[model samples]
Target: MTRALVVAAHGSHYNPGTALPAWRCVDHIRQTGLFDEVTAAFWKEQPSFSTVLDGLRSNQVIVVPLFSSEGYFSQSVLPAELQPRVGQAIRITSVVGSSAFFTAVVADRIQKALVKANFPPAETAVALVGHGTVRHLDSRQTTESQAGLLRGKFAEVHTAYLDDEPYVADLVRTVTCPNLVVVPFFVAEGLHTQDDIPDALGLSDPLYESQVIQNHRVLYTPPVGLEDNLYTVVLALANEYSDSEAAADPGLSSELYWTSHQLAQFGQVSLHADALCHVDDDVNAPDLEILDTPEAIRAKLRFTDSGEFRPLPTRRDLPHGWKIPAPGDVSRWAALQMIYPGVWKVERTCSPHEVGARQQGKYRPVRDISRKKVDSLVQSVCLHCVRHPSWHDQNLESVPGCIEPCSVWLEEAIKP
Candidate 1:
């Protein structure tokens, strides 16, 4: 039976930015390739919750709300829109906040801060930042709940807010811990994590030690929903009702999943060209290369891993127009694209133009690559970048150098 996972999120009508975290979670889950389809729906955006099932062919669908609380939206609004018809099964999982293992996830995060700064528990203070809507008492309950769990382990535990009391700007005045660590209880690092909250707290940069705000130096971590272990948390949330054959690989680690190409940049690994077919081979393979025009270069610009171009074997068609440089040319391709964007596009498909659009003065039409093929490539690049050491070891500013060159940072965004 065809199965799907529809992640439901309460998106914004006024600000499209709020939906990013849910979109990110959707992207994260989709990369695992655990189901026939993984998609997203927003309550206030296009494909709103009311029409969430308008185009689903899956026999079973598991809708998991990305909310961190089981308030009115998860308990009432989302459920009201998720009715399934005969031969179509729709199962709704509990909100992510209800995950039984979340406390453990919190514990792990706290430990990382301790290890990073090696601060004495006696002096370091932990503050959990939340939306904390004063209108709804239950809204801040999750923040309170996590703070309670962390209190036993950290010397100082504080709960600050954006909408309610104990404003993050006054964190130092309210929470008297010497070295403060603020963890945003957010689904994603949208405007709040990236700006509003940081601004309130006087943070000048993202993911770094902030200049003393109100006389206190603060260290802020990335938003909570992007946690690596949260994959397990999400799977656990979906499995409460998912009967599909997909099983979570708890032991599978992306820690070393770096492609051989990435490793060769540092002389840590090698790709022997003699053992592989060269790009000049004329082996007949599927022509899945998409073109925007006759001028479009037909190379495997999409970095997918489901399989290779059967028409050509290995690096045989790589460096499409030039000789594959040395053995680790694929990584070099990524580096070249990064350091030399202008030069790298020479071999990539032409910038996609709308079909029937007038280019220069002549009308031109073009077709896109097969969705499945692009999906395969996008997933491969996503997995590669998301698991790269730079993603974890370095901050966001340093992160793009690895992604932009690889063309995984959406040089070719899927027009969802």
Candidate 2:
């Protein structure tokens, strides 16, 4: 029998949001019976790239990155990891949730979101926010390309990023519209979703109050996450493999399985050990700002393994021991959108025209790319959702694959 494995992705550094979508995708695919097995892995955290290949039950593993664009992780990191398994009876194909074809899907979601907020194509400044990286130009390029497409399809669209040039604030300043709308082009509401973006715009946490920028002329919308539209995105990908013939390789499967198991086991052991001791007070604690830096977090943790963390502490809970907050607890991960409505058009009832009519005097529309291909598999996905809407719930929670953030250890009482 041929078995297929589909892996999902998010950027990681012990952040649940970074790894949650990947795990959720794997579980969703498996429940639909579209693949024999599906396993989720990450660029950071547990089930490292080195270990993911070890746990494959099928000779064919289809790795799908959940990221919206081609960047370092997709271009450099993913390719290097898969190179070793090239001809070893294991084949890997890269598929992702959102890609070039997703612009239309996002455009649909954006228009709906704007309409509900009483935003118009004329005075409304549509800001496309992305997590741009200085390390790779592709991050900004992807965001820029997507914005250009949106401008083509709709009027008054502007592009911005959390990093690099043409910063978000600068881009938003260039829009001539009296009112502005910011849409985060991210997969989930994580650190950037919860903290960085809002901080950049001078908005408060639990950002519900719609305040005007430079005196009520500009408005910011809550982020887009967990919308029913995402369900549509997921369905599109699963349908791609529903009819493909499965190719099996027992030897390859065993190797992948053992490697993953060992890596998971090692991670657990290291966590246990790290949990045992308090941070040495003698060392200067890293500033709260540095926790966002992965290398800084790694250096401060004082891992005994010389590279990673040690085992978890067996004690009930040490006064000096570090306890990382659950991803769900991060103020950054909290439901900031719930406090604010109209982030997604799903629950709101407002006509697109009625919302934008107020600002309908001056603006520009951007061209959008339409590249969606519907196949027989898409029908299969529609059927799956019809039969089992609850399928995603099973994987919606955080997975065991993520490594805890270094913040937990920072909270401990340091000893000299």
Candidate 3:
């Protein structure tokens, strides 16, 4: 039996930061041994809301929404896809906005800002900036309600937005305090939180990148939902349900990922290569063959067992500043030398070659350890793996916004 957690949100198709905070929380929670599998999905991004549930293996899945409001997307759109028409153990948790704990998290951030930035509540006013979309009245309701929670501590509480009146820029006119603390009421730090919010306020520096904006003092803080304490709110929501009956084994097929980065650290190839890039089993893979001229190298066996990220169209000549450092194949060493003779070198084994001529071989059940010596001998350097067949073979057409850059050397795929 197995259990899984899905952290669902609105992610970016272009910007990675848009969905990172929620993904970061999902990853951190996964590490605590609460679930066997953890994954993330977004409405505007890859592994989209339309297909997020398909990858889940656990019959008992706890899905927690990372959104800031209980809007149409959360109440209707998200539930419609997840709620079973007949029966299933899948449970959906509350959005972060409804959690009173989230309000406290925001308050906690305000208190910290007052301490670090030296702006006490007696002198500083807090402005909670939100999107406040005019298309839907419910969008601004949470931002308006959350202000009541922080009113007692601050000299004055101001609520502002980008689309509605009393916009983010108008904060300069509405609040009279000499010191103002601005906290973005967003789920993640992306274009709006990091770039647009600053530009709207006529700020030269990036969002939350400084304690003070311009000459006059103003404390800028990151998105509120990303506060560490909010993880408690998520766990609490899932724990509300009673324990379920035992589940069946998750016999799901997993795709393999590769990267030299992880292979260098552990001196083992199989255990860590999944860190580079991966995709769930759905899309059909194209026939892939790794060949040098008419001959395929022995290293090709590593890829034969599993696929890699998007494959390159035609091999580009090695970039000037980059080299393979150690090409794992002894057969390819000659060809690599033909291209750039001094680019790579093969390390010799530390065997008693001079004393004895006898050689013997035997089958090893756990071959993962046998490759360690070769992996250690090879000098692995960073390569732009996005184009290689190894990258393309995983069947992912594009990288997700929330996923960190792939480091293939780590078995756990994501690297900060």
Candidate 4:
């Protein structure tokens, strides 16, 4: 029987780096050749929860939330969005953050940070900083649990929160330790880890590796979620669902076999005999860079023409004037995936009406908005996006269209 693994994560619309750890984990798992398919889905980004499972062909599926705590997202949002399938046997595993393996990973991070700082673990006080919410206790509970497990190994292990009582700033100011190490209990290094945490810790300089704060030699480590061995924790969480007895099918090949018709257009990108080109007519004529492989295409799309990082590929800001050679059907489909991840599968599985209904039903922010508000939001947000809501009506198969309202639009609609 075919098996699939879906790594669910809370991706960011604003910061692209927020989703890298989960994607990296997916790449590692895909390399193992254990599952027939491996894909990453996000709550706030593309290949969203609404469409992640739409195109899977697996008989058995396991979804592991790449969350650090059994908080609002992992406990409530994920289960609600990942609806039960009709024929497939789907199992949602406990979050990676709650796993015993993750606890060890955090401990390992703290130990390594201490050793690198040349501080003895016995004399160092560890501050486990978490993004807690006042609306729920799960975040605080998970943070305290990890701290509890490390109390004996360190001089003192204190749990602090960005949103809850005993705030991160308070802990940094009052913790009694000659040497302190702050470890962010986050899945990725986003604005929280890069700016908020550092600011709360009283570290003004962004480049400072270590600083003297309140007479304590403070050493801040990268977020625990960015740890290189996180794939092990993901595998450990899904171990029960993995079939050791079943012979593994060599997973989906990178070379996608597509027919000539399917290669004609990819949203705003078009394929030609000599090269693959952007369909947008308004883009300024720039020097066309030669991109031969899918990897090269992906690298080119990472930034805009002006060299600014393009976090969202669906945005209309796709840097133009790049040419990809039209080698074979494999290269064509592979290039489409690189340009718009999961769009081809989603287009095949869902109709325009189904996608529209999903956006209205699954996303409360989109559903709650008035028709006028939606029109205004769309004019402001969707107009600048490469994908269009009306593409289906226009019968523009080449123009990538939104099946459901994206997180960016939802965020705009929800704003007061």
Candidate 5:
């Protein structure tokens, strides 16, 4: 039976760095060739939780949440979104943060800090900072549990939070150790580790590896999620789940229904002269980059034409003057996936009503806004994006419409 692994993560809509760790983990897992297929599903990014499994070809699939804790997203959101189809067997594993391998990773991170500072563990304190919330006790509990495991190993092991009591700011001010190591327990580095935590700790430099604050030498490490060995944690969780679960039906293949013939033109890309080329490229355009592989195309799309980072790949700012030589249908299809990750599956399956339903379920904040406000937001945000609104009919001859509102649209609609 063919098996698949999906790394489900809470990817940021505005910050591209938030999704890098999960993608890196997926890349490593893919290299091992442990499963028939490996992909990533994100709550706030493309190939979202609602549609990630729709095109899988595996009979048995394992989804491992890339969250750092068993909080709101891991417990509630993931289960609600990842519903399996008939004859398809799906197993959702415990969040990666709960894995025993993760505890070792945390311990290793702290050890590295101690060794670099030449500070004895008995003289230094360690702070495990987590993004805790009052809505769920699991986050705090998991963090404290990890800290508990290391309590006797160090002079003091404390748990701090961004939301709950014993907050990050308080921990920085109250901790008495002359040498403290602050390790962010986040799944990835983002606004929290890069800005909030550093600011709260009164560190002069946000990217400082070590700094003295209030006469106390403090060492700040990168978030644990960014560790190169995170794929091991994912592997451990998948192995544990597979061992306990029963065999599943060898379901029908869920390969993408659309063909390259159906993809003649996308937002700013088109098939021309047996190659997938940018709409603006011509003989006059200089510095044209030749992308020979789908991976190369994906890497190129990480930034805009003007050299700015593009957090949302669906934006209208896809760079020009680059082309993928797609002499065959397979190459064309692969190029499309790199240019528009999950659009083909969405275009093939989603109807107007289904699109509306997806939008209603995913963008709950849209309900609170007035119709006029919603229209204005859509005009400003959706119109400029590469995706056509759901109102447009899906035709292979034309650019495909979006199946639902994107995260950027939802974020703008919910703005106070």
Candidate 6:
């Protein structure tokens, strides 16, 4: 009867904006009396998934990922972190929150943005650009899924990506539409949304462009984060967990609630320690100083259960213009290296903590069992999961991209 709620998000040390919507989702759910307990976890940041379960006060819990599409973190990281046990008889339900409804929402937002700009939606070529991968076809599937629903709702719809086959550049060759409007299917307005996509479209700034990309007469909408309609996504997820179908066992719900509370306590403690590095004047901070030392990194992994993003400490005395506050992680590490090479050294690592048995667990032997179970459980959950695991775990290795840096540092060569 113990029911708990874990809303997982792909956290970034490099973008506060990425985690913002996930947090908003958790807040909306808590406002409703849906579960005996509710908590949020992240792939990065504190409240690490390693120890998220210790906080569960409900006998049953529903986990919803606040991602725009099914990608690696939703599949591999989330399942591994919430690794299920056979005999525990824990009634855990996982719902993939990336829905076709989101596509309609995005389309609606685009129509409105264009209307405000005095452009007709029927005349504009809506290009939904996503970050696609070559490994798993699901990233492309997700974009296609979005596009399919969008095409049904709108007159003109097209799709593109940053990587893999049928790329953004191909739009110039493939798309037959005349008046193009690009809408990035991304959660934030980061480098790719700002610098890379715009550059590819051949516009200095579509906001001020007198000429358009490919001489196709284009219009670029602001990244989706700036749109206000996203709140609907969060509200709908909370309703899913709180509705009448959820169990009414007070005892079970109470236990899960208490468990979630305890996990939250432990999570907050580790979160504080993890944030400590933010204030440390250590020049090696970007190199993941926490992961460099065994004990230092172990401190953050102490959570027996409970996971989610919490505030980290940053240099309080940093002067304005000295350094822009950057989210700290590997993808950002790579982006920064690509953008400002001299500012930092990029070192690739292979020994991910979540890798095989040895690096994954707190102890070597237990780690082995956990790793084995992790493999088996992932396959099992994917087969019976509410949504396709391929949709979430878009990467081939079934692991997060950022953590691969440190994990690789320990085992393999660091390549971009």
- Candidate 4's C-alpha runs over 4 A off are 84-86, 243-247, 250-261, 270-300, 320-332, 345-365, 372-380, 388-399
Error of 6 at 322 (Å): 23
Give the alpha carbon lDDT tens digit for every residue of 262-299 in model 5: 55567778776467777777623456788885457767
The global C-alpha lDDT for each of the candidates, from Candidate 1 onward, is 0.54, 0.45, 0.53, 0.73, 0.75, 0.47
Instruction: Give the TM-score comparing model 2 with the true structure, all chains together.
Output: 0.55
- Tens-place lDDT digits, model 1, residues 388-409: 3232223333312221112222
State how far residue 227 of model 5 sits from its true place (Å): 0.4
Q: Considering every candidate listed, which one attains the maximal lDDT?
A: 5
Alpha carbon deviation, residue 267, candidate 4 (Å): 3.0
Q: Per-prediction TM-score, please? A: 0.55, 0.55, 0.58, 0.83, 0.84, 0.57
Q: Which candidate, 1 or 2, would have the higher lDDT against the true structure?
A: 1
lDDT of 4 by residue, 286-355 (tens): 5667787544676688678898766567787777777776666655655665676655322533333343
In model 1, state the lDDT of residue 19.
54
Candidate 5 segments whose C-alpha is farther than 4 A from its true place? 243-257, 261-264, 270-277, 282-286, 290-299, 321-332, 347-362, 365-380, 390-401
Q: Which residue runs does candidate 1 get wrong by more than 4 Å?
A: 11-24, 27-34, 44-47, 243-416
> Which tens-of-lDDT digit does each residue in 112-201 have in candidate 2?
756766666765667878878887777777677778777854457877788876687666557777767777777665678777877787
RMSD of 5: 4.1
List model 6 lDDT by residue over 1-416, tens digit each.
44556666655555445555554554555556456555566655433343344444454556666665666656555666565433222322323325644655676657766766555656666778887887656766776777777675545788888886667877755656567777877765556777777776666744633345665667777666445556556545544654344533545432222111212111112112123222224423455433332222323322212332222211012111111122333223322221111111112222222344433322223223334443454454333321222222444332111222221122222121
Candidate 6 local lDDT, residue 215: 58
- CA-only RMSD, every prediction: 15.8, 20.1, 18.9, 4.3, 4.1, 13.9
Candidate 5 clash pair list:
none
Error of 6 at 260 (Å): 15
Q: After superposition, how far is residue 223 of candidate 5 from its true place, in Å?
A: 0.5
In candidate 2 the C-alpha lDDT for residue 139 amounts to 74
Better of 1 and 4 by lDDT: 4
